[model samples]
Target: MPSVQIKICGLTTREALDAAIAARADYCGFVFYPPSPRTLTPVAARDLADRAGARIGKVGLFVDPDDALLAQGVEAGSLDAIQLHGRETPARAAEVRARFGLPVWKAIPVTAAADIERAAEYREAADLILFDARTPKGALPGGMGLKFDWSLLAGYDSPIPWGLAGGLTPHNVCEAIRATRAPLVDTSSGVESAPGEKDIGKIAAFCAAVRSA
Candidate 1:
């Protein structure tokens, strides 16, 4: 299998951003959802993103956000890509792309084989696809740190690049890569000391595992 591409999501601090950069993560995700503990203001996101520079891809994560908010995020000039982590339709994804002229990644929640079928819809709408664990009923959409069965992705294929996320940590990342052979993998709570608190050591360890996979 090829080496995994690591994306550290929900970053809120310069320390964490620096840690992610030093770890050489392929992508750094900034949450724009207000309910999420890792959420960042547009200004804050821009600052961290500016600090990240060109060392990694900056991803703006949102959950069914309005076009105005999305426009503000894009105008901030910190993000290279947008990740729709909500119940957005394929048309909405396309609209965001067309309006902003930025790459789009639509996140799909997977818990069963049927869930995998949803990937087909976003394949044409997004430049990339993110497979994350399904948020339980009555819960927030994402950043819950939950993981679904990796075996479910064994035969998954799509024209767009795909990423595996949720509950990924230093210990299980290698196995997750080996099982799903995901070219890209993302983590948020898994590398944190607590909810919204990123641990630099864990970040480094997780990156090391990804590089060695």
Candidate 2:
């Protein structure tokens, strides 16, 4: 089996970032969404980003962000990619990519096979499409520890590069990979001890699980 890529998202502390790096994660994500418990200010993000410095790919996660928000987040985080976890149209995704000149990942909430098919809409607009579980009304877009049916992606042909997210814990991540054959897997709450709290042990375990799979 091909090696799977791992992204540990919603990192809010130096210790957490260090744990992710030490565990050999390919990507480290910083949340820019205000309402999420994992949210970080540009200044705070900058500290973590500066410390990260080429050790791992830094990603900035945002909701339906405007250009100004994106600009601040990208500049401060020195983000390698922008992950949009909101209701952005394909045009907006393309616009973000053009304006920022960075790889753009649009998160699609999956509830059914049709949701997987919707990824085609972002083929031209985004650098990658992330399939995550759909949250309930008024809940956070992701990092909810909720997962969709992985079988929905079985034998599914993606129009562009893609990744998997939502509700993945170290215990189940191996099975998740086997079910979807996903090239990349992302997690946030799965490695946390509580809301917005990153557990170093969990982070290591999750990465090891992905590699073992």
Candidate 3:
């Protein structure tokens, strides 16, 4: 299976960021969307990102943000990459990557096999693809810890560097990796004690689970 990369997403506190780096996470993600409980202001994210330094890649998660927010994330958050978790078109993803000069990761909400097939639309435009569980109508985009069928991705040929995301926890992450042979795994609410609360022990355990898988 080679080595699996892990991203601890929606980190809002310095403690969580420190925990992620201490646990050897491959990427540390910050949410920029205001509707989320884990949302962080650009200045706060920048402080944490700077503190993290180059030890872990810093990723900013956005849900169809305008250019103003992107500017703040770029100039302040010091993000290494941008994650678009919205209804962004392939062309919109490409444009963001070109204009921002940062790697663009497009999140595809999967509810069925046909949903996974839609990844091909961003094959050429996005630098990476993330498959997350599709939430109920009127729900927030992601970070809900809602999991899709892991088997939906079994033996699937992903168009770009890709990952399996929704509802991953330390208890079941290994099964997810084995089921889909995921190259990367991302988690937000799964390791939390409560909404926006990152548990250090859970963070460490989740990373360990990925390595063991």
Q: Tell me, by lDDT, which candidate is best.
A: 2
CA RMSD of all predictions: 1.1, 0.6, 0.7
TM-score, model 2 to reference: 0.99
What's the lDDT for residue 86 in model 1? Answer: 90
Candidate 3, TM-score vs. the true structure?
A: 0.98
Look at candidate 3 and tell me the lDDT of residue 190: 92
Which digits, one per residue and each the tens of the lDDT, describe model 2 over residues 1-213? Answer: 679999999999999999999999999999999999999998999999999999999999999999999999999999999999999999999999999999999999999988999999999999999999999999999999999999999987888989999999999999999999999999999999999999999999999999999
Per-residue alpha-carbon lDDT of model 3 for 135-192, expressed as tens digits? 9888989988899999999998876899999999999999999999999999999999
**Per-model lDDT:** 0.89, 0.96, 0.93
Ranking by lDDT: 2, 3, 1
- Model 2 poorest ten-residue lDDT run: 153-162
Put down candidate 1 lDDT per residue, 1-213, tens digits, no spaces.
666788999889999989999999989988888888998887887788788889889999989999988987776637899999999999999999998889999999998988878888887789998999998887877778899999999977767799999889999999999899899999998999989999999999999999998
Whole-model lDDT, model 1: 0.89
Worst 10 residues of 1 by lDDT: 70-79
